[model samples]
Target: MRIKTKGFKKRTSVDEALKILLSHTPLPSIEEIGISRGLNRVLACDILANIDVPPFDRAAMDGYAVRAEDTFGASQTNPIYLKVAGEVKIGEAKEIEVKPNEAIKIATGAPLPKGANAVLMYEYTRELDEEIEVLKPVTPGKNVSFKGEDVKKGEILLKKGRILKPHDIGLLASFGIEKIKVYRRAKVGIISTGDELVNLGEKLSEGKIYESNSYMLASLVKTSNSIPERKGIVKDNKEEIKKAIKEALSNDVIIITGGTSVGKRDLVPEIIAEIGKILVHGISLRPGEPTGFGVIEDKIIFMLPGNPVACFVAFETLIRPMLQKMQGLSLMAYSHYLVAKGILKRKIPSEIGRRDFVRVKFDGKYVEPIRVSGAGILSTLVRADGFVIVPENLEGFEEGEEVEVRLFHNYFPAP
Candidate 1:
């Protein structure tokens, strides 16, 4: 009982393909939250300030909160004098006020005493027993940080879903914020499907490769602030694959790798057909040609290509963005820079009917192809900075012509 898509046509653009995934209620919810200092959590809501930053009028200079008029015409040669009422230390505050022709000593960050409108720097003053001589003119409202200057009460400090970086914490601490609400990370499910795949510790048999795709996928998910629920390796057997997909769908987005391509064990697509609807198969893309999508019990089942590089690239480029969206991040175009030097001049090979992503690396001044052979070479992917997608209308890229590259970046910092 399989509902497989046959005579595959590449109608799926990357964006259109992703939208089809949402036909079911496949997104993770935001209710699951646990606190751990919230160091790196995305904000669940915009934070409005309960208190003003600085809390009161404060001195922005270490000098005197002065009656600016009293310092009028003051000069080094002909200094104007005003009685020094008192000093306002950096931390302490008082109820003192100043009348006309008066001033008070103030340090930087000290709250301004009542009736004082400006500050004069310490370098512009000379002291006397009963008064201080102002050697420089002071203007009204100079060197003062007004109450709520840095931020006002009830102002939106951080928008909902903004990731809390280190500096974000400092702003909260400075404003006396001890806690905040942030969106919990969405949980993701990672499963590897293939009889040829073995555990990492196991010695490689003649045709068996150690299970690295699962670990790689898990790490990628974790880096994006998503929790990865690893369901380990499932053999290519139909029923086994079905059970794995069933369990993974229980978590969040289900990512199944290995049995996606057409092979003896490429039964993952077949199994999903029994349980769900295959949205798209045989994407018109390189390195990840066998990519497919389905919905299983309201969960997304992404059958990523089995090759390690293909799996790695597909997750980072295609899947990570969707996860970012689930965490409340508004989807937007991000720029990925590609720096490379061209070595050869030739036409690129691609049908005008499909888009091809060509892997390239930096050669000092320009990008160069790291893999002239094909997408199966994971090692060459390690050398690439980004990809130049060759469109189907164009047979190939002219070797010497500069090209646009879709760079792959670790958008989330590596854990």
Candidate 2:
């Protein structure tokens, strides 16, 4: 079946579709009780370093801190031994200053003693007469990490919009940063509509399926590091649909799945027309032919296809970006894109004016095409590595044609 949208242009261009999506009201500002240890949450602002890393000059190894000139010509055959004046423990300092032929024993991360310019590892010497023998000659400033060596004060350690990682956390801790400021989470509302859809754990009946799309969409929203509020499922009645949509519009963004495809009972677009402008009734795309974009009282409303794989693909391609934008992130977090060759030969039909994203597997660095079928076949998505973009102007991919594949999940980093 083809798109049934009438008047003011029928076949939607990718650019037009994007422009239409952007035409909707920007997501509203919301207040949320934020949490720490955020993995993929977009940063609210730039993080500047208040303290220099290392804080002070410290020894890098368990060794002796001595004047370099005293052991300048020390060798393995005839070593120089300095009198062990005292010992410095890690995170402690000594009051005594080192003079000629005098050394202070220091452990790893210990502050350097006064008048000491170099450190000699314990492996390079032996102990005799309460003095350590240095086999290797020393140079000035060797084996010592200076204050601000790794990072300087006032340096922008982690930039704004960066999704926090384990390494980022360690870097923050190195600067004595115990807590940080992050942006408030995006508040999203979900509404699932269908008389045939029943709640989970209920007894199954003919022509009835559990309402899994709402839960799946909610999980995806959570995975994107946002808050998902379930608005519950409504029946096929138009008045109830309008009321449910209006209620959800009170949030930052709203997502309505099912009741989107063009059937006698699919009143999603009609109901959207009653409440607000229908920016896009049917996107020129595959699997999600029933997809639509619109607005309801300043909140963005997206009608996604009822099928599982279709909804999943639409969320990755469409809904994910909007949520990131609302969170102040410039790009989609936790997503990667790259180009690879098709391994197996197959042909798939795409809409005349719409682009198609076909799933394929990674054969080494290149992708091998798989038997991608209807959106109802959930296993097709499980077996795929990523999806390829088939341009609307050209025919579908051939056996060995290279294409751009947008990854669905992590495991393959951008090449």
Candidate 3:
């Protein structure tokens, strides 16, 4: 199952690889979905508030509603008494008006009566027979949530291409919006290439290994808000690989794991070059140095390394951004992650022309590296809190150097 050959000679820099990936045309389909199903979906159009958020002037607190001028100059020693007009029940919209020396009972969030302009908390007034005595002075419009205070009618609340979150869903619901238009999730096809690959739960032969890269890639695709379809495994044969790739082109993006490096069984790169143009045959990055990317027709094909760690790195560094672009999300938005500054506990070495992603766990102040000698070690990624990207220009970082650590999904070492 092993092949011996010279390694890839020409390697594309990280920036160049990203540029090539961005060249592919993304899927341009839109679908309307309910707000409940809009989480993580990119908005296809701007969301303008059809009506004001509150829609009407509402009471901001629970108390007696009255004209603010009525309570002016009133103190506990000489309190002004107002007759109880009526109670305005929430959602009932009772037409209660507070004339001079009159008050109406109002609750929080209840629509304010047409003639009332202020609210006096129940604790601030005492019941005197049938009237409540207001012991405090108030200003006009006090405690009144005016109409259009929160949101004006026809105001643009959310812009297009914004990714929906839970808060966004609630905001849409506030306007009684039940459905919205969003960019359709891009469907990606994941194909595992190699005759030595075996499906999970199957008995592993002497040379065959379990096929886990497909699942990993599928998870990555899901994390990127894209749909993933595992197209199963294909052998090293050129025709079979080509056939699989041809079928996968139906998807928005195709990912081929294994058989990307320069080896006798590495037919993915060759087949990709034959069917489409290979944009990047190799990358100047550790763990994922053997990665490849290409375009066929209007679809993007990513050739990732066979090692699970390498495949994960390649997907995060390249494929994730492409998927975001297809979904109308900004590639520059890294809000999902938490970034922190920590001092390196020890020095990390790297080649001059190659970028390295060193996974390290940080205890709020110091970053501890997760040692790994081979890219096939998947535990390194699991144990590490995040990774520090060493640029190609710098050789490495010295101990005690302050480095920006991009945490993995907001995870940080506990104090």
Q: What is the C-alpha local distance difference test score of candidate 3?
A: 0.84
Report the lDDT of model 1 for residue 77: 97
Residues 185-214 of candidate 3 have per-residue lDDT tens digits of 888999998889998989998998898899
Candidate lDDT values, in order: 0.74, 0.75, 0.84
Residue 22 in candidate 3 has what lDDT? 84
The candidate that wins on lDDT is 3
For each candidate in turn, give its C-alpha RMSD to the true structure in angstroms.
3.0, 3.5, 3.2
**Superposed model 2: Cα runs more than 4 Å off:** 1-9, 23-35, 332-339, 361-373, 404-415
Q: Write the per-residue lDDT of candidate 1 for residues 1-415, one digit (tens) a residue.
A: 2333353444576566656654443444454343336667788878888898879999999988987877889898999888888888988968788777788888899999898889999899988897788999978889999988889999999888777888888887777777777665777888887778899788898998878777878888887788898889888688888877777777778888887866656888888777888887777566676888787776777889888777765675567777766776755433224333344334556776665667776444566766644655676666776666666567777767777655555332632
Model 1: how far residue 186 lies from native, Å: 1.7
* lDDT, residue 52, candidate 1: 89
> Tens-digit lDDT track for model 2 on 1-415?
2332442255466557766676564742433322346555555667788987777888888889888899878888999889999999987766867789988889889888889888888888888889888898879888888888888899898887777776777777666676666766767899999899888888989998888888888988886677899998799998999889877876778899888866768888888877786778667666676777888777788888888888887886678767666666664423645444444345555555776767777654566666555787777888888777777887676665555565655433211
What TM-score against the true fold does each predicted structure earn?
0.88, 0.89, 0.93
Better of 1 and 3 by lDDT: 3
The runs of at least 3 residues in candidate 1 whose Cα sits more than 4 Å from the true structure, single-residue gaps closed, are 1-11, 23-28, 31-40, 332-346, 406-415
For candidate 3, the per-residue lDDT at 395 reads 88
